[model samples]
Target: MIENRNEFLSKIAKQLGRPQPTSRPERNFSFSPQHQVLANATQEELVDALVEQCKNIHTKAITTTTADLVATLKQVVTDYKATSVITSTDQRFADFGVLPLITEHWPQQEVATHQWQERCGQDNITFAERADVGIMVSEMTLAESGTAVLFSDKDKGRSISFLPQNSIILIPKSTIVPRMTQAATTISAMIERGEQVASCVNFITGPSNSADIEMILVVGVHGPIKMAYIIIEDQ
Candidate 1:
C-alpha cells in the first residue's frame, strides 16, 4: 500500500512538471486592399456595375435628387404591399414620407412605443420573416467598394440590418465616397469632433453568403437572400 501510494504521488509530481497551457495572442484581422473587389472602380463603372447587378435580381435602380428621393420613396412604398410594421432609425426617412406609411419602431420607450430592438426582432419573425423584403437606410455608402455602411444612431440599431430575411438600402448619393480609407478617416474625424461612436459600423457588400458547407456556395445563410442598394443621386 505504501509503495502504491508512493508510485501515485510520483506520477502526480511527474505530471505537474509538464508545460503550462498558454493562450494565443489576439490577432488584428484586416481586409487586404489587393483582394478588395471595389477598391479601384471608377464612379461611373461602379454605379453601372451595381445597376446591372440590381437588374439581374429584378430590383429597380432609380436616380433622384436628394429633394426627390423622399417623394420617390413615397411612391415606391405606395406601390408595394404596405407592411403592418416598418422600422427605421433615420429621421431623414421621415423627410421621405415613408414614416407615416409604416409604423415607427423606436429604440426608446414612449407611452405606448415598444423598444426598437425588441420590435425589430418580433417584426422580423412576424412581418419581415413572413414577407419577402424589408428596408433600411444607410449612414453612408462607399461608391468605390459598392458597400453600404450602417451605423447605430438615435433611431437605427444593428439588429434591424442583421435579423431580416431581405434588406433594401436607401443610400443618398451625397454620402457616396471614393474609397474606404476616406470613409474611415471621415468617421474617425467625426469621432474626434465629439460625435458618439456607434455600437456597430456594418460595412455590407451585397448579401450574406458562404461557401463553407461542402464547399457549396450559398446565399442568405447568415442574413438576407436578396440585398439591394438604391444609390439615390441628386441628379
Candidate 2:
C-alpha cells in the first residue's frame, strides 16, 4: 500500500511538473474585512445585530432586564404550555433565580436538572427527551451568526439542549461577543489559563433544520422544533 500510494503521488507530481513539498505551508492568520468589522462592533450593536440575525434564521430572541427575567420566563412557559422542563445545573442560572421561578410558575410540571456530581444516566435522558422545554445557560453568544455556545460537561449535559422539543437559552448580555473569532479567542484563553474545557463545545445557530429532500426546507428534523433565546441585559 505504501509503494502504491508513493507511486500515485509521484505520478500526480510528474503531471504537475513539480515535486510535492515535504514541509507545512506557511499560513496567513489575518482577519478578513468582515471579521474586522464585527470585531470592532460595540456591545449594543452586537446585541441588535444578534437579535436581527437570529430572527432571520427563525430563532426567537427576547431581551429582558435582570429584574424582568423571571417574568419573561413565566411568559415563555405559559405561551408554550410546557408541562415538563429540564434546566442546566450552571450556578449562573440559579443565581438568576430560574429554578424558583419554574417552581413558582409551573408547580405541577416535571423538572429534571443536569447534575454536576452524578450522571443520572438513563433517567436524565428520559427526562430530557420528554421535556416540553429545555433551559440552558450559554457560555457565550456570537452576534455575526446568532450562535450560542454550549460547552457540555458534567454540569451541563448535551442532551439538555438537543433532546428536548423546545429549547430556551438564558444568555447573559455580557457574554455576547461580536463574532465567532471573539468567542474562539475566549475559549483559547481559558485553555491557556489551564481551565478544564468541556469535551464538546456545541455551536447552535438555530433549531435543527434541513433542506435535503426535494429542496424543501424543514425545521426541527433532528433537534428542537422551537427555540427561544432570552438575553438578560442586566446580568
Candidate 3:
C-alpha cells in the first residue's frame, strides 16, 4: 500500500533531476470560464436553455409535471409507434412511475417492453437492437448542450440506448445543470469521495449523425435516427 504522495512525486522529480516540492501551488485565477458560462442563470432559465438546445439538435423536448409523467410517457410511446421497447434496470424508472407504464401499462396498450437483466445475457442486446425505442433516465443533464449523462452498469446495459432505432430519455428538472463543466465537477467529486464510478459514463447529445464524407450529413449512421427527452418537473 502507498503511504503518501511523496513517493509518487519523488519519482517524477527524480526523472527530471529535481527535488520534489513539499507544497502545492494555489489557483488565483480572477475568473473561471466554466462557471461563468451560466453563473447567474436560475433553474428555470437552465430548463429553458435545455429545451431550446434540444430543438437546435433536432430532438423533441417536452416539459411536464410529475402528475402528468405517465400520460406524457404514454404519448411518447404511442407517438414513436413502438411495437417493442427495451429499458435499463435503472430504478429511476420505478421511482419516477415509469416501470408500471412499461410493465403493466404498455401491455394494456399492446406495447411489449423488456427490462435488462444480467441473467438474460446476450438476449438483452438482441432485443435492444430490434426494439423500436430505448428509454433511459438521465442522471444529470447539460442545459447548454442538451446532453443526457448516463452511468451504465450491469443492470443498466449501455445497449439500451445505443442499439435502439429511436431513444427517449427522461430528465428530472432538478438534475438540470448549467453545462458540462458542472457535470465534470459532479464526477470529480464522486471520485474524490471514493465512490465507485461506473466504467461507462455516456454523454449523449441528440441523435447520432455523421458528416464524415464530403462534409455531408447523415443522421442515424451510428445510433438512433430520432431522439426525444421528456423533462419532468420533479423539483
Query: Model-by-model lDDT, in order?
Result: 0.61, 0.83, 0.91
By lDDT, the best candidate is: 3
Decide which is better by TM-score, 1 or 3.
3
TM-score for all predictions? 0.61, 0.83, 0.86
- For model 3, the local distance difference test gives 0.91
Better of 1 and 2 by TM-score: 2
Task: Let me know the TM-score candidate 1 reaches against the reference structure.
Answer: 0.61
Q: Alpha-carbon error at 221 in model 3, in Å? A: 0.7
Relative to the unseen true structure, what is the C-alpha lDDT of residue 227 in candidate 2, on a scale of 0 to 100?
93
Sort by lDDT, top down from the best = 3, 2, 1
In TM-score terms, which candidate is top? 3
lDDT score for residue 224 of model 2:
94
Per-residue error (Å), model 1, residue 149: 0.3
Candidate 1 achieves a global lDDT of 0.61
Question: What are the per-residue Cα lDDT tens digits for candidate 2 across 107-223?
Answer: 645533333224676777788888888888898999888899999987688898899899999889999998788888889999999999999999998899999999999999999
What CA RMSD would candidate 2 show? Answer: 4.3
What ranges in model 1 sit over 4 Å off?
A: 1-46, 49-61, 65-85, 103-132
lDDT tens string, model 3, 1-235?
Answer: 6686788889999999998888887889987788888779999999999999987888999999988999998888789889998998987887877778888888787888899989999999999989999999999999999999999988899998899999999999999999999999999999999999989999999999988999998889889999999999998
